[model samples]
Target chain A: MEATDRNNREGLKAWLNPSRYGAERISYWLQRLTGVGLLGYFIGHVYETSSLTQGPDAWAAMLELTQTPMGHMILLLVIGMSTFHSANGIRLIFTEGGKGLGKPGRPDYPYDAVSLNYRQKSGIWIALILAAAAMLFGASVLFGGE
Target chain B: MSETIEKLERLDKKRKEHEKKEIERSSIYLKIFRANRATGEQAHYDTVEVPVQRSTTVLDALLYAKGYKDHSIGIRYSCRMASCGSCGMKINGIPRLACYTKVSELYGDTITCEPLSNFPHIRDLATDFTQFFEHHKDMQPYIQNENADIKDPSKLSEFVQSPEDVDKFLQFSYCIKCGCCYSACPTVAMDTKFPGPQALAQAYRYFADSRDAATEERLELVDDRHGIFRCHFAGSCSTVCPKGVDPALGIQLLKGHMLGYSSNEKKIADLKERLMRK
Candidate 1:
């Protein structure tokens, strides 16, 4: 369907375009997307691991797939996503638990508060840094020895 | 009986003729959503144009359509200024006060107006605000004082506050309860359990007030799974606020307070209680 047609359908579709909003909204969409990705990976991992019950031969065949570059790349993707998700999740947990939010001051005209703003932006930065670091480590582990 | 029937038919024909002429004279077309609550009929758009003016607002256009074109159009507005906040509706997919939105400012000839999202639509442009106001009331949007003597005005002492203290919640106090913040909120759209921006912001307003004695109670009210935590700082609430009431900021500040990160110097002091005890 055309984008306009889909948008005209009704209900909330504004969140799909985070660029139209601010940084925090983008973070919200990314968090949800990463969460779903992790869930999918978990189910796949469980199925792959359960192959051990089928016998040694079946388990060996399953392990053979991981030898391919495609499998290595997939693993890297998972590692990156998980690292970002976990880091961001911790930030969310702290925020929801009401931690690290500095004192409330008297509101001035054009009333704004920067404490939460700074914390949220920093949280995103932390998650990105952790994700990048994890991907680098995974790349070395996958390709360095090879 | 035949003569009376002929007379009734003549009157009906004249009215249709008059309507055709009226439509021809109209310059601007108002495309409005129409619905009937009694029949449970499906809602549909009806367009009718009215004469335009330089100072014409969306509310004026809607009023013209209602008075001159279609009587079935439903809308709620009073105090045509932005103050009443009763005329909040989506004009071109953006939530705005109808009274505050000028028709001339809208691009193109046709203006598409719809009821605000994230609320139950009562009819054409009117949405049910019962739930909205209930959330506002739940947060105790008023100043709570335990020791103020209402019976005798002479016995009460003035509560002195510095300029800095007023600044803490001054902008948040400008909220007209328009529900624009509520409508623009993605969290409210996704999660029904969320307390919404308006309520959480007002909760902070009173919480920040030096005169209000219910700071602790207010904090506990919003410090919950469905309270301020649900807000991911979408910022739409602040962007769409016509009154410049930054509800997003209020929610964050409230979160900061709950986390023991408050920066406000003057705390809510119970002078009466202290004096009486002395």
Candidate 2:
């Protein structure tokens, strides 16, 4: 009744859920989440950088806040999120431009989608793997005590 | 499946009777969402138990509930088979054709039947498909041939095409317009103006047909921001398709043609004044 315009639209709840849908939906969920996370980080990074214009102490204070163990963990999370976003984003770019998804054909009985071919589904897996690898490597470097 | 309870059944006569009752639970509980969406009445789940046979479908179960339990329980169905595509609803949290889904095929004891999401609920289990059909209509879901002359009823001319060409768009052509794919789509759940998987797939169906000539024009229709590009390839549309019409594949291939990846450049040609002169 409240939604007379759209009528029971699932909205963000459906968009955030990657469980029921296939690999692409998982990617969809990851992409949107990471995009938002990255946007927040970008704004914070800009503010962090702009602290240098205030004074040397402000810059040092900003560094002290961000260069700690907790900050490193947050950075690690950001790294993982960004890696997933970009990796999945690349896959999406190719997919949206129609590269990896296979050609349409006569769907056989007990049908499996040719559209969700090995290449397309694997893209989500590859993005996740890439994100994991980046996070692990970033963890080693960030927390290596250099 | 009965063997799992056989061990306990042999323990005692009481246990055997209990096991028999367990095995022969003839009626299943259907937790159906009841609401007159037009009237905006209170929405609630009406759990109704209907006797089911081996071959009884979800549609049959609903019909029984409507007939015996409550005549006011509203439902829309036609052609008790899956072809008509009318009796599509969310059965056990998945969008499916009720006639196509047997009650035995459902997993749990209480099968949840609700009107399909992302559609305006008409009554209890029926949803209005006006928007969905409008999107289908917007796609111009028909062959647009520039070279055809219906001069004589006796003399018929067919557009020459190979079987290989038919294979390109044949799967997408199987769409019954049940709205199962549309309801399952995450993009459709979010964006209303998006042509949805069905229309987009049908757009590709006609686009890929060898007999159809309007390629650039069709591509132009779906190349907008809210068109094919809005689809993030969630693949749920393909997952829930009742007739195996892979709308995701069709939409992607449609995107390929839209972005010049597949290189479709067909256009309308000028009609000849006379067939004999040409």
Candidate 3:
């Protein structure tokens, strides 16, 4: 049993690389997806604003098009991805600052004095809910009781 | 003459009692597992028994075994006082200087010594430090000042630094580069690209040095995935350092520097929160 426990500990140690490759891989993909989406949104937003150069009539027409079903769905996806990416980024910052999820003796958190993982997890849930709310609000604002 | 002789006899007996002190002086038998390079296999153990004195260091006993019993039993030593840093090997499964460790510290009559882990063994105890030093050189461990006007033989005054600044990097400069910490570091063991704590700490030492001008250039080199970010702060490097230089602290400080304004803003917010709580 002692040998089994020792082997388990060693196995965990071997997996927990200082480079944090597992977490990093997750962060990398999330960042890439969010970045592309955000970039596309910015470009489209700028093009829509460029409708002002056409006339105030064209500008209002561009704003009216944003109230469509596809526009609402894209905005929701953007908000969800961006909020997740940013929240996880902040969590990464806290992870290095000695904040992590789980109990003290848990293999994931070997030396956490205060529980950060739960808080960060809670923050993620809150951020997601808030993002969903914001997307709904944004759609409503654009549509205006339509 | 007779009285003087009696006094001398009393002194001799007293001296013997004090030095010997009735401590259990037993023979500690060591079975060292060495990898023979010639055959490319694990070498058989050659057990050597040496009298364990109270103050007798492991290096002293190894030397005694080499000198008296078996001349072929390989071991390395220089500066028997632990200053030379050559006698670093695994003493009972931990990397330490043989010169500094007493034989009595071992729990049992038999203790093992082996070459440092994850390094090519040159002999029974000596692992080649060439790769370690090569990595050190790869970090560009010197001041790279772009300022051409600062050069003058006499005009170069003592680089005025604060007491706090001097205190910060003082411990890092004491690194003997014994490769004990490097051997113990898990990052260096797994990844070839990730520069180990010794080199990273050395990089931090120069980076923190007020006189060094090329901060961004040096930071840029080690700012990547396999660089300073690779340090998970396992803290084995700090534990094994003979000089007590905390490479873990240095690595964390370097991480703090790399993260920059976001962390600083968080710190400010945390401070404000603390003040409000107070």
Candidate 4:
């Protein structure tokens, strides 16, 4: 079927474009993307572990994949993504559940919404800092260790 | 004396040049998005040159284009002030009201004007708001008092509320229905069933209102999986709101009440009607 411009919605483009908005909006889809990525890694890890049923020969072959340089890099990324995903998810539980966000009041001029202010935005910064620290530690363990 | 006069002449020339730069009058091209569904015309941009001052708004430039350049250009506006909530569009990819946003506030030599996303496009820079209004209607924006009947025969009854009580819902009440928040919402872009920010905020406004009854039905209305739950609280809704109506806060607070985290109990303001026996 041919297409039409009738429904010209921004679709997922709107979700991906963080440059258009502020911290909270950017972290929203970043959190979701990392979550999906971690899930994929989790499934791959399970499949890799399933090789244990075939004894040392099969397990050793599967372990070879992780012993590769690419595998180490991916593992390091997973460590960071997982850390961020969990930390931000915990923050969202309180935010989406309607705590920490201040009660609505008169929005005086130069209107600052309590949701977009530093209190909520600071949570996003904390999550990023946690992710970076976790990734640094993972790099040391994966690459710097004997 | 002649050397001093010459120095003053040079300074005056410099002062005049400085004053000219201070006013900052320049011409900017408004690359307006043009669409024609009736003629099945594919969407495109038509660049129009508009002389602008520091005080010129997006609405002013668009009006100039329509007034002199092209009479066929489609644009919607009522009150030139921000109160009408008519002229809203995506100026440089951000959903904002054309009337309220001064051209000086925007950073660009070429301004791009497009119809708001998440709404069905009607024509150039104009989108269909029927569905948006319908979603708003579904929320039952007006007062839904159960005991609205007049119990007495002679005097009038006024639902008197304190300033503290008014503060709860007063912020959300300022929605101009401009749909800037709706356009800014990423969830609204993808999820059609989600009631969007405008409607959900109105729901919280009335639900939080001290005089309003019918809390159970209001809660049930926005309690669907596609309803309040769809809002991930990305907060683009709150950020894009031109009138300071924080729809994101309203939705989250509503979620709080829905999830039993916050108190749903409203004192149901005391009726100040005359109870005098004639």
Better of 1 and 2 by TM-score: 2
Best by TM-score: 4
Please, what is the whole-model Cα lDDT of each candidate in the order they appear?
A: 0.76, 0.82, 0.65, 0.86
Q: Mind giving the per-residue lDDT tens digits that candidate 2 earns over B75-146?
A: 889999888999999998789999988777666788999898899777788788988999999999877765
Writing each residue's lDDT as its tens digit, candidate 1 over A46-143 gives 99999999999999999999878999998998898889888988887666544654444433333334333678788988898899999999999999
Please give, for residues B189-264, the per-residue lDDT of candidate 1 as tens digits.
Answer: 8776678999998998898888887877887888788877778766678767787776877787677667766544
True contacts kept of 2: 0.65
Which structure among the candidates has the greatest lDDT? 4
- Candidate 3: give the clashing pairs: A100-A117, A101-A117
Going through the candidates in order, the fraction of native interface contacts each one reproduces equals: 0.14, 0.65, 0.00, 0.72
What does the lDDT read for residue B100 in candidate 3?
77
Residue lDDT tens for model 4, B1-278: 99779967876776566445543548888999998876788889999999999889999999999999999999999998999889999999999999987776776688899999988888898888988999999999988664455554344357788898899999998999998999999988888778999999999999998888878899999989889889998899888888889898999989988887886657322222222321
> Second chain of candidate 4: TM-score?
0.85
The interface root-mean-square deviation of each model, in the order shown, is 12.4, 7.2, 14.7, 6.3
Listed per candidate, the RMSD to the true structure in angstroms reads 14.8, 8.3, 17.4, 8.8
Worst 10 residues of 4 chain B by lDDT: B269-278
